[model samples]
Target: MLARAINYAQNQRSYMENYLLDGRCSISNNAAERAVKSYVMVNFLFHDTVKGAKASAIVYTLAETAKANGLNIRLYLETVMTKMLDYKNEPDSILEELMPWSEAMQKSCGLNNGTI
Candidate 1:
């Protein structure tokens, strides 16, 4: 059964070309995985208010998203969080700069050289 499934996938390879077009998934769960670290740390260090916890979750989410986008995790988080705190009323376009698929992140990092 497994061999049959593998054979079917191989036969349908062209149909899945778009997903593999860049020769990579262009997505990684690593950021989401790393996000847990900050939450675990904060949960231990500070007593959680609902709002405060929620804020941390958002930061971690963005941080991981930034990481997955190829931005240096440390730098992007620091820069974005600082901006977010100061510019609480910033427009969506500004915040959108931090998205995982943001071109800013893509341009900063070159193409993936990893084996697909």
Candidate 2:
């Protein structure tokens, strides 16, 4: 089972490496590994059930991504959650707004202050 899982992951990685794909890259997923380590730390400390672990992982990933983008973590999250609650809609498409590369944030503080 473990071997099959590894092979499946390799195949998926290869598929994602297609040059024409917008975010495709022929590289190991080390960045994602490091990003998930925060959730792993929480799991190690609390040993929560799968549902709680998943929720923590999602929130950690968002916060970490915000930090990576050079945004103030607390402010970014507050702004995002406020907008999300105001919209009262699923936020799948709005994830881009949370990213540091968005012009909305750049215009607020300019490039230097905004570059994470």
Candidate 3:
């Protein structure tokens, strides 16, 4: 058992060394674990099929990205959906304006506007 443990540690030594070389490298994945915890719980509670789960994952990711960008989640989603309808037949490049980081979206849906 001790020999197996030592072999495992030796195999992982390079990874540990990399962590030591980077000050910003986390020793554990707790932040990533916490980020996915809600999605896991929501999948169990709300998703009934694989298709539903995939759709939920996309929406959840968009909402999280919007929140991280300081945009009001509800307003940002609403604006994007509404705008998408108008641009559905247009070129995909036009959709860039609908992103949370876009100047127009920031002005309309950003937290600084007291919309949140």
Candidate 4:
């Protein structure tokens, strides 16, 4: 076991060195682990069907992205769903305006926009 550990360390020496040289590198993946915990916990709820799981993953990703971008997740999703109907027959390019990171969405759904 000790020899295996040393061999693994040796193989990863360059990565370890990069971590030490990069001040911006995190020592642990706790943040990413925590981020995925929610998805894992709710996974069973969607596991019954592949389509359900895929839908859940898409919605969850959008919610997380909205949160990360400082947009009110609820408002962003609500606005997007409401506005999407208007562009249902339009080209897909029109949907870009509804993205969480888009200027219009940032202005309307941003946490600092006082709408929350």
Candidate 5:
């Protein structure tokens, strides 16, 4: 069963073959692969279940994006979790407050503060 599955996967080649059919499609997922390389390298970071792995990926994305945008990751997540409950039901107005580039979000998360 294992050998058959491996053979089938190699024959499928969908992971790389898609690049031939679509110019916009990536030739390689090197960026995404590199993004998870560190997490995967740390043995303790591996999750045994798909659900936990997905959850970890989501958290990692949030942290990385927050840090990249000059927001305090801890504060950004805390504010997002709390405000999501209040604004999630509202209209697009939440976008103004939740977006990392938005003035409101920057101010709220102290991204605009005179500190790195």
Candidate 6:
């Protein structure tokens, strides 16, 4: 059992190391994974207040969404919020502008490195 476990771990490590050869691959998903898991656990603490729970969930969603797209939350939110004012009357336009994978949003968030 011990030998099998060790072998499995070694296999996984070797697999992950190969990703380093790919220029865009990230060595670390730990931070991002932990952040998401932490939110899931933390949500239980705010379950008492419906309004607060909803608000917290939205913030968590926004934070995770921004992080997923290689965005700096503060900068992304600032830029998006400001730009959103111009398109408030046009919901569809605002939706396109706020998409994490959109070209304009990628540029605004400094994620123009050929990524989504």
Q: How much lDDT does each candidate structure score?
A: 0.64, 0.67, 0.86, 0.86, 0.76, 0.74
- Measured with C-alpha atoms, the lDDT of residue 109 in candidate 5 is 75
The C-alpha stretches of model 5 lying farther than 4 A from their native spots are 1-35, 43-45, 111-116
- Better TM-score candidate (1, 2): 2
Off by over 4 Å in 1: 1-46, 85-90, 108-116
Q: Per-residue alpha-carbon lDDT of model 3 for 1-116, expressed as tens digits? A: 99999999999999868877879778886765787797787665877899988887788777887887899999999998888899989998998988888999999999999887
TM-score of each: 0.45, 0.63, 0.67, 0.66, 0.59, 0.54
What does candidate 1 score on TM? Answer: 0.45
Pairwise lDDT winner, candidates 2 and 4: 4
Clashing pairs in 3: none
- Among all windows of 10 consecutive residues in model 6, the one with the lowest summed lDDT is 107-116
lDDT for 62 in candidate 1 is: 74
Candidate 3 lDDT score relative to the true structure: 0.86
- Arrange candidates by TM-score, descending: 3, 4, 2, 5, 6, 1
**Tens-place lDDT digits, model 1, residues 2-115:** 999999999998876665667566445464566587677757468458788788777767765665566666666655656678668767777765555767645543235221
Clashes of 6: 0
Question: How would you encode candidate 6's per-residue C-alpha lDDT over 1-116 as one tens digit per residue?
Answer: 99999999888996869868888767887776777787778665858888878877777777677878887777777777787788778858558768766777677775545433
lDDT of 4 by residue, 27-116 (tens): 886776787687878785658888877777788778887987899999999998899889999999988998887999999999998988
Whole-model lDDT for model 1 versus the true structure?
A: 0.64
After superposing candidate 2 on the true structure, give the runs of residues whose Cα lies further than 4 Å from its correct spot.
1-14, 18-20, 23-26, 42-44, 90-95, 107-116
Clashing pairs in 1: none
